[model samples]
Target: MFLRRLLPLSRRLFSSNSSNDPASIIAELNKEMESVFGEPPSSTHPNSIDNNVMAAQDSQSVSPKIVENDYGLTHVGSKGEAQMVDVSPKENTKRVAVATCKVILGRKVFDLVSANQMAKGNVLSVAKIAGINGAKQTSNLIPLCHNIKLTHVRVDLSLNRNDCSVEIEGEAASTGKTGVEMEAMTAVSVAGLTVYDMCKAASKDIQITDVRLEHKSGGKSGDWSREE
Candidate 1:
């Protein structure tokens, strides 16, 4: 929720609902900046090649040097500083990411949901809408994420009788400098949460599990897909 959207006086009214507070928005933007620029190439070394053997080796292989920024802590700098990644130099490309989640429910609850028999109405229908809304709200919720123009967002929900569960999948696509993995994951999260919130009346034992990125494509790192 964004204050700009919540307290909109003009055309930008009520945008980014997840960032409803001003202080939070500033903090989020600052955090994102720190994450983006936290790392730089520590050093550049020319490679020596043996023409005959066609071998190449790094000249600065052993000297103590600043290590590359770890993905686990992209927000922290080599010197323990925070920075915003400069995306101006990055080329915009079509990026897509998919995430999945499973919601396990009791037999009674599962049957009720699959048949849309719950008093709360169509669970999957509401969840799909919630998932899309969640994807749109990802930037606002995440502290270090850019407000991306989403080209496409799709959320699928299927009742799995064999597993006594509901399978949820969310796919997000954008043509931008960064990937949309968070958006996809957020979609699945909200969809699963919606199911819990809606079906809690039926049973409180519902479990959400295996929330993870299933696939991603585009960007400099290329593509990745989870195995099983």
Candidate 2:
């Protein structure tokens, strides 16, 4: 009876040590993986574990592709089918996005906006308000967008006397699951529209151009910046 109890205790101690051992744990994990996958994992490169993990993540992640639309809006689609990205499993991170738009107004409209002679109000102030509001309402305005919390939205308008144009720049920041790229773009678009509305009496030939993402930071894919 005494020997039997000691045998059991010795076996228990050996089992616990084996289970806690790194080599034994690795072997057990390999067996488990083989049982599930029906094959042993290849050991191609030891340092490629992170790369493999990233590749697996990329395979499971939702990415966007460009497609043409009737309203001249470029959208993300796959195999001729429009799809919204699912960001459910992504981590929340601090993100900042910036966009710019240029409205090429003729001399008359440019002068009116620059001189603050518009009948409605100050063109820059009204446009700034509109841009901020548009940034907040980005998800509501754009279809299939996820509502996200925004931290800040800023709009800046500048007049180029030599080119006879007005440039609108928008920046949006957030700490959330998704980026504020759409918000920045929407702000720039709305600001340009507001400018056009304020100066339409002077000229109707204003052209909005280059509404695009300038820079973005944070998220899994890392930072991006447009080339000047």
Candidate 3:
């Protein structure tokens, strides 16, 4: 039981293959002695069995690197088809995702929306509603997306007059097998598009950019957040 408790720690401190090699195991023990006593082992040392045990302990301390391969489909097949991820056997779990998008419009268009002078009427409110609707319908728009029930969806919009841009944020939550990252991203994208549709009459220079997932939680790999 004590050996089991110390095994993981030992593996982290020595070379990766030291545990399998007798000579390397002995060297590891000698190195630990040098560290603890600040001196080399004596040539006349008579306790061979103790020395071997110490060597094994030292060998167990080496650290190993974890390597993972990219599983995403990056190339089209011979028949011009894309590969989809297989999640058939994965257990269902709760998941949430958040994403953001920015729409940069001309100063005139921004001012028109801000002042409620656009002929379309209530650009921000319409976009927010569209975003929520989009979140609910994301699986329909994107192929291979699992159609799971969304427990909640929220969309927030902010105006940056100084930069003539509208920032859109979307959040989606679900209790199912897959994550909602794509849904959140799709919400922001559709919302930005709606803004462009409503305000296009005011200015034709609107540009939607930076549609991306901000954070996600729950799943086998655990949680993740994109760096700012």
Per-residue alpha-carbon lDDT of candidate 2 for residues 129-226, written as tens digits (9 for 90 to 100)? 99999999999999877788899999999999888998999999999888899999999999999988988877889898989999999898689999
| True-structure RMSD for candidate 3 | 18.4
For candidate 1, write residues 1-228 as lDDT tens digits: 344433433234236675588786766565554455654444643332244234323434532234445454656656657765556788999999999999998899999987889999999999999999999999799877878999999999999889899999999999999889999999999999999988999999999999999999998999999997
Per-candidate TM-score against the hidden true structure: 0.68, 0.65, 0.65
Highest TM-score: give the candidate number: 1
The Cα error of candidate 2 at residue 116, in Å, is: 1.1
Residue range with the least summed lDDT across 10 consecutive positions in model 1: 48-57
How many backbone overlaps does candidate 2 show?
0
lDDT tens digits, residue span 1-228, model 3: 545544654665554754577676667666655655678657866798799989988767643221112333423333446755667778888899999999998888988888988899999999999999999898799877878899999999999988899999999998877889989999999999999999987777899999999999988868999997
Q: Which stretch of 10 consecutive residues in model 3 shows the poorest summed lDDT?
A: 63-72
In candidate 1 the C-alpha lDDT for residue 51 amounts to 41
- Residue 91 of model 2, lDDT score: 96
